[model samples]
Target: MELAIILMILLIVVAAAAIKLSDVGLTFPFSKKTNLYTPAERKFLQMLDMAVGDQYRIICRVRLSDIVSIRPNTSVKVSRSAMAQAATKQLDFVLCQKDTMSPVVAVDLVSVEAERSYKAQRDWYVSGALDAARIPHIRIKAKASYKPQEIRDCIHAKLAPLRFQQPQEPLVRGTLNNDKAPLRRPVAA
Candidate 1:
């Protein structure tokens, strides 16, 4: 019992010493004020907001995976690693429907940095993914200030065609044979 008590006292002394030493220079968590959007980005986002108005909601810094998915068909399978890779990429902004939250268009901010090889590759991947999903995207160059009308024009030019595209009607086998004939299944012998 004596040995146990002494050991406990020694452990307490050691812990107290460590704590005293840590007071000299141990790092503690600190919170600093930081703006989420840079000045140029903020200006562009404001322009986008004015252009979209109440028709669509502008979402910023959306992950690529959040907006896209691999549509698995009966004959095709997707690997987990592929999905993880896509999740790492992100978009500058996305325009979504206010009521349904459905993504309407993706918008990318283009700057001089985008001319670099790595940035160009990233841009290609983003555009290709959006194309595969049949989502419209607009790449606008970064500017000090943007006119709301110009942004509106750009969105209209890109999305109008997609919205008005004609949907293909499913083929009816019986209709090709005879217009008046009713659809009927084959009789068993």
Candidate 2:
């Protein structure tokens, strides 16, 4: 009879503990926020919109992974590690064809202030990758004011060559020449 009474008390203690634990639900006190863009970014975006006019679309915070891939024609296989590294990097902006959303250029807004070595290294990597991909990349300094004409000229300079060049074959069919280098800039199509 005593053992039965002890067993019943133990059961009640366990049940009480379980109930107490269950009462402590997880929650956060966060609320929805607005205006994700910073003041400088907003200003630059305005200038960029005016400069490009209706010819191209300006997209912000584009992932590098979306812009590049291990070319399909390459005999070399991209390792999982390489892809994971690429996924982490992102571009500040991408200028695309308005109707087709084809990326025409990639832009990075850099501060004149001294940055950490790692950030500089990452920037170098991004630049090299974009260059290899034959995607024109512009590095703009974060500035108090911008000249729309200058910006327009910069975009035009890069795009003018592409606009004139005619490709003999589609980009997908081009084969990779080596393991170390990226596929040759798709024969100007």
Candidate 3:
């Protein structure tokens, strides 16, 4: 009977350590492990960090309007230039590259719509086109002047077919930069 009570007490203690204890408000008991980002992922994160900067969170919703894939169709063959021109055209303003897959764009619809709405909506499509084109609204606004439904449909159509998987950076085989800086010195080998 004493052995059974001791075993029961040990099991309860182990369970308490694994789960959230009511004594602590909303605190889980497990130790966490963190994974680090790769160089390319770090660069991408840096760009996003630059774009969004101190605004860690935005209050407005964003939607991607449309995307057209650009290809290198014409080759300058007469000169026999064998270089498969590595000139990469700008894909989009906000893009997230997936592992072994094409990147996805996240457009700033709030900025886009706000800019268009401020211009009185129809200015871009009509005889107001010339005036609107010169006003700098086009640059700040979305490519397609979309309605609520249009924005929803556009994103659904574009993203529905694409599958986003976890980024694989070959499981970084080195120690982390303790100071969170890019400057790496020779560690004692």
Candidate 4:
């Protein structure tokens, strides 16, 4: 009983010392971020929201693994390798269908300097993976300002191939057809 009490006291002293040391500057090396996005990313997010918010849901900073999955019937080794590669990468933004929440497009913001550096290699891998998954990937240059219309046009161009035409004519209401007189209700006799 005496040995157990002594050991407990020693452990308590050690823990107290560790806590005091942490107060001196040895605490966990992390703090909450003040802002979720940088100024440029915030600006672009606004533009993207304005451009397509009505049609699709925009999600930011999504992991690639969340957007894609390993194909079936693959060897275990290859599957593990593919998953490992995707796990560390992230998409800047993902445009998902409003109703189904299916990912329609992945967008990345690239600076000129990044394109000239090692980031280009990362982009190549991302592009290849997106292509293999049949998801459209768009890269927009990071800029101080973006026009919503321009952003809309760029997205539309990339999605044009996925659009299907309707076979039937749209109904036109509240108008005379073939120059006929408008229908009038009969007056009470």
| lDDT per residue as tens, model 1, 18-132 | 9999987776777875988878789999999999899899999999889888776623335465567678888889999998998989998877565672234446777888998
Q: Model-by-model lDDT, in order?
A: 0.83, 0.80, 0.38, 0.87
lDDT of 4 by residue, 4-117 (tens): 999999999999999998797955788999999988789999999999968999999998889898888999999899889998889999999999999999998877666474
Ranked by lDDT from best down, the candidates are: 4, 1, 2, 3
The pairs that clash in candidate 1 are: none
- Residue-level lDDT tens digits of model 2 in 90-186: 8888999899998889977766667752234347767877887889988777889998898899888988887778665665775566766885557
Best by TM-score: 4
Residue lDDT tens for model 3, 1-107? 99999999999998988675655867678775564543433343444445544433311111211222122574557213322221211112343333322324343
Clash totals in order: 0, 0, 0, 0
* Candidate number achieving the greatest lDDT relative to the actual structure: 4
In model 1, where do residues sit more than 4 Å from their true spots?
1-32, 73-77, 117-122, 167-189
Candidate 4 regions off by >4 Å? 1-29, 113-122, 164-189
Worst 10 residues of 3 by lDDT: 58-67
Off by over 4 Å in 2: 1-29, 73-79, 117-122, 167-189
With a 3 Å backbone cut-off (N, CA, C), the pairs that clash in candidate 2 are: none
Candidate 4's displacement at residue 58, Å, is: 0.4
Worst 10-residue lDDT window, candidate 4: 113-122
Please give each candidate's TM-score: 0.69, 0.69, 0.19, 0.71
